[model samples]
Target: MSVFAARVCGFAEGGKRRHQLRREGRLMLNRFLSARSAAVAVAVGLAFAVTAEAKTVDPKTSSIVRGDAAALGFDPAKLDVARAALKADVASGKIAGAYLLVGRHGKVAFQEGFGVQGPGQAAPVSDETIFRIFSMTKPVVSVVAMTLVEEGKLDVDAPVSKYLPEYANLSVWQADGSSVPAAKPMLVRHLMSHTSGLIYGFITPTAPIAKAWAAGGENRNDLTAREYAKVIAKLPLKNEPGTAWNYSRSTDVLGAVVEVAGKKPLDVLVKERVTGPLGMTDTAFFQPEAKRARFAEPAKGDAGVYYDYAKPTPFLSAGGGLSSTTEDYLRFVLMLAGDGEYKGVRILKKETLARMRQDETTPEIRKAGLFFPGPGMGFGLGFSLVNDDTLQRPGNGTFSWWGIAGTEFWVDPKNDVFMVFMVQARELAMEYQRKNRTWIYDALVK
Candidate 1:
């Protein structure tokens, strides 16, 4: 049987069987720690203890019921099947480790950790294991921008050139190698919805503008957000503003806009306005050195590399730069699922979240199939909206997105479900995402 199946079987056998599994978990943890340096082992052990003590929620008022799948309206047997499938994939060596959390009706219904920290690492994956969230950072940054909007500091419909004057003279590139002055200025909404005409340098390596971005130190660690914005504005756009939807570095530009409008650094603004209010203590641009032991390592065969999470870079990529634990991010997503409130802390107004979840893509853009990777989806302010319920598993009106490093989350407001899957392997991100979605939805009994 798979490792996950064995654990589930133990739970079925009674208290004695459950005790055996707990003992086994401790034994494995101890053996893993023995191979690591003393200092590292001690730090990891402390982190594990802290995670164990943290409550998923207040049990009395929470819908979360530990190991009671039926209480949360899930079939226990199907949940077992889902766990086995995930463990089988890990055993196949496609991914190094994974963490999953499912919340329904405002409480955690299921939570599980699988595999080791990395290919050759001894540490076992746990709730506290931090993973690089990549593009998932976009949603958080978008919400922060909305908060500025609430304060009358930023306007989504305003011309982006109003905040960053360098974009005023921007031009658009054509297939015939000619350039034309943009007919209209790009708006803040365009950036948030990925209709700003910008393109990611690495997405199309052979394009002239993409090549120019790379040659100009677009990913340089020393370049500040302001400096990067200036560099990006000078490049020719991939399309006319609002004419097409490209998964671009527009959120990073939005980050620069937020910094200018909020009159603070991007990191500081995110903490003060979003994460801090939501109680996501483990989410940040720079992973602390002390928590380095708890950070997950990527798989050996990830398709692309990531920036050093432990190193502080001036760029502060709002598009794809953030590390967070499963628990910390769950709180963030739960807030969204609850329509801007979590445990009574309101990070955003209900109306703001409603606006964020609405489809912002034009039918023309959707028909052209340029908004995002999947079918039957539309682009929202900072997320992908489910346009056709028949095509995707999540109900209509769901808002979701994922990161390149295999982290994904979705809030299904229609079904009152919020699920997060955290992993460090990018080679099979979409495949794993589909598998997890299928398994989770299949086990849903409500």
Candidate 2:
């Protein structure tokens, strides 16, 4: 959920400087790093200024430093092979464009951009190309919700009906299509954990509730968050609250909970609480017309989900609607890696973050559905918790998530490592995430 390094020294510095970090006051130690490394690390919680060595953006503050792959304990030539493989995908037009970033010991090793901005477009992808991060937005919203939880403004145990009463009498849909009242109240934690029985239409396209959603126009962009929650509440749920772990609209409902609890719109709450303080300048529900040209495109110009990014919409899909750049999103995850503080700004407390990373589901609940985290992972408050090395993933204590349109990220506090992969090809997301993990983990030779 979040990590902190205090009074540290010589991290991932080859064998030349193997000094141990003093776990003093945790986050306060960030102030003790050497001026240059401290700047790079803070830029990583990263102020995320991508440079030409790795394509940097104009920084609002200190810039993130890219490390030598060999010095960081990665085989430079092997790493090159991995990069070449992805670059080949771009060249073959398998994906529109891509950006990959890997950071370890609070310092990034590389950030690479590939191919054209998208499809047949003339622009090449750069450090600032914005992407539709889709479900990746959930983790951010979950962070924002946790911020409110830290402030004592939101209660994780409280019934969703407490914030949005529309959820109070929600109905559960049976296989035979009959509905019954929920056996338990859907709590705030349920929404964050996607155990609220509110499944996504696309994920449950064959379900009766999914059909109801389609006919009821639940996907309308014109309704506000509260109105959208009302529409969702009226529909029958896929299961009883907390009984199963289904990929859901729960985060979208949590957005309404956040809006009602925080007394503001989802976008405003995110800005004022999370993104603004962390300097995630390019992360938002939509981009301004000025920044529209920087938006990434699909192989087919109009095939991507975001066709109205420049237009106004009353409801921002807190679960699946956000556009961001690698640098901006990197800053946010770096903040998580920094234990909820970035550039000296504290969002959620370290203990709160720890709670979010702890496992929240049983094997029975996970076995109930597709269980997107795969073999070794479990669902946490808002992330996939890596509990074992059973899968070709990171070690235990890694918490991560990804966007539907090929954007994936993971922060491994145990290894002081994290990665961000950005691309606009929806079909390649799962495929690339699986491949990139091997490419990255194999290179972690030290």
Candidate 3:
């Protein structure tokens, strides 16, 4: 039986409880029909109200129906089905444990956890499970940079060398693998859009600099942000800063730059300006001793046991290293959904949020798959732009980013939906997983 099934069996005791179970259970079973049926789309006002309800409603309420789910054009019964499907999938080894939270407008319509924290634990998953949200950290870093932009501390168009003069002399890689002088310097915007010529050491095997990056042995585990920046400064840049699009360690570098500009540690600045104001207490570069027990170990496959990184590293990778819980991340998404406000806690101006969402890439680079795929989608400041079908669902104006360790989150302002799925496994079957996830959304909103 599925986890939901097992849990429900415990709840279906005597008298009125049994009757309630039968009614809700039967309704849930019929959700597949309601999902694909020709019911009219939910009204915009109701959808908004439903999402808002999710933000405020207590989780201890009845499981048969959720107020916000119903308002967002989802049948409560169908939502139950989706929940069951998610549990069934995870239990059967389609994936390891996963925590899902979906909301519309500013409210969360559904929050559920499935499978075990590890193999032998009987305690079911909860909202507090900590996840290593690798690349998702990029968005948070980008938001920090934008916050700096709002404060007039940085400019998107200006050359980064203006702030760090070391970049003033960067050169490009020639066809023969030798360095050549660049006509133009790398700019802050180049780093943001990934049009800057810098390269991520992991992507290319034949490039000499790639080899250097591998052998540099910078001891990322022991270096602080300042130390990492100093190590990177001595390396050769892959290309001229702005001539082409290349995914690089640009965001982490940007984090170092943020440190330089803010005159504080990256973690400290993020805590003060972002997570603190947004109430994401669980998000941090270093896990507190008490919370370390809950950190989900990264795994290579569904059945493979999870493991921590082999090295004892100290550097907190701004591009990829924040650990957070589904609830904490959902709160971040909710703030974005609310136009930068959550329960009157505003971390950014509405206008600044608008800028972050705007497409920042050119047409040529977008077609080259320099960023995410979707119609009308492109890379914005930090998150993947939803401009094409691959990144978008039925809704337009959606954006998200994922971690290497199977954590994904997206915000759809057009549909007023924010969804997060956190897991510990690596190399997920993304297409199949996305199909299943979309099926649930379609069924719920139908």
Candidate 4:
């Protein structure tokens, strides 16, 4: 089941709460909704029509509920309970600032901004805040890559060496410290599926690639894609291409490939294929001085620790190197919901969009459990695909990817639902997964 299907199942199990928003008496639905709310609701209905029957949240209801979230989806009794628990954590200094946006179809029914910006600041978070989207940028990069595919400039199944021949002689890691030569070259699909033997340079505590990645060994933000590929060319892959699934810098390499294939810089390719078409004006690698203040300060745990956006040596990591607004990111996700088109611009073909969303991993690959565990869940091109609702949290048919700095986004074709949580809390983000993410989705299931 997809996240939307899980949401529907959650709703069915949620029982009476699903009908709580039904208008009564003179409460006109229009009075409760905002234009944005209605548009999203309509989009959700249109996008996920066949996954599982989903009902759009009325526009008026969305607006009214967003203004006063206590009435949104909370079981009235649980409302106080959940709020108290959350407040208690904040009071104990367990968190700083957190923002959440939830919408069904195309409309946002719940928007909540909570906590302080830091230890001494009381200014609450707003919707316009920016976040370090980290690996979440992977999917966006994947989208950009697919756009090239739609234009017939790239092939997901083709060997990476076809475009960057240096990758043709890559070798795999041996169990001991030695290396073994690859039987085949890494393919574009392998990179997207994480089966390209590339290492995230962060995963696998004992892996040599992990150590090298930590030392910025093969991963360097200072190097251009071409330069970065040269560095990776000298390193040994952790596994044979397509033989295992390991989160790696393969997407970043893909970013470089896009540049070579399109004869443009990575950022330029991203803009031409994604941001420009989606009207994501604020999404980019370099943040102008004027917009610097809006970029949220990343936190260590509960303490909001500020860091420079421009790493002393900048490497436009296509895998994790973009800053965006909640609204701008929403537009990008909306395009995914619409299956490639947003408003009038067609970003990808519906068929291509479907292919991107389905499981790209074989049953054998999935059974190897190289990624997150799920009953029917498997890796898609760049996002995680839902295989069974029973193994999922709330949203079914839902695909998700998050940034390292407490930012997350998901698209549930089943519910026409798309959600994003933007914050500066990194180490603290995972600590409150249930209250911060799981419960938030649980609250937005309708």
List of clashing residue pairs for candidate 2: 3-339, 7-29, 43-46, 43-47, 50-55, 50-56, 50-57, 51-55, 51-56
- TM-score, every prediction: 0.83, 0.85, 0.77, 0.77
**The candidate that achieves the highest TM-score relative to the unseen native structure:** 2
Per residue, candidate 2 scores C-alpha lDDT tens digits across 123-223 of 87876888877778888989888877766688999999999987789888887877888888999998898888887776656867788876766666678
Error of 3 at 186 (Å): 1.7
C-alpha lDDT (0 to 100) for residue 196 of candidate 3: 73
Who wins the lDDT comparison? Answer: 1
Candidate 1 has a TM-score of 0.83
Comparing 1 and 2 by lDDT, which wins? 1
Cα deviation of 424, candidate 3, in Å: 1.1
Compared with the true structure, what per-residue lDDT tens digits does model 1 show for residues 1-446? 11111110001111123234456657756776777666765666666555433322332332233445677778778878768876887898867789888868877778899988777887888877888888899999998998888777899999998899998888988777667899889999999988888877666678787777676655555677888889888778888888888888799889899999989999998986667655678889888799877878766742226545687766787887788888778878887887876775566778888888887787886554255556777888998898786753788888988987678999987777788899877667778778878888898878
Q: After aligning candidate 4 to the native by TM-score, how far in Å is the CA of 236 from where it should be?
A: 1.3
Better-scoring candidate (lDDT), 1 or 3: 1
Please give the lDDT score for candidate 2: 0.75
Cα-based lDDT for every prediction: 0.76, 0.75, 0.63, 0.64
Per-candidate clashes come to 0, 9, 13, 25
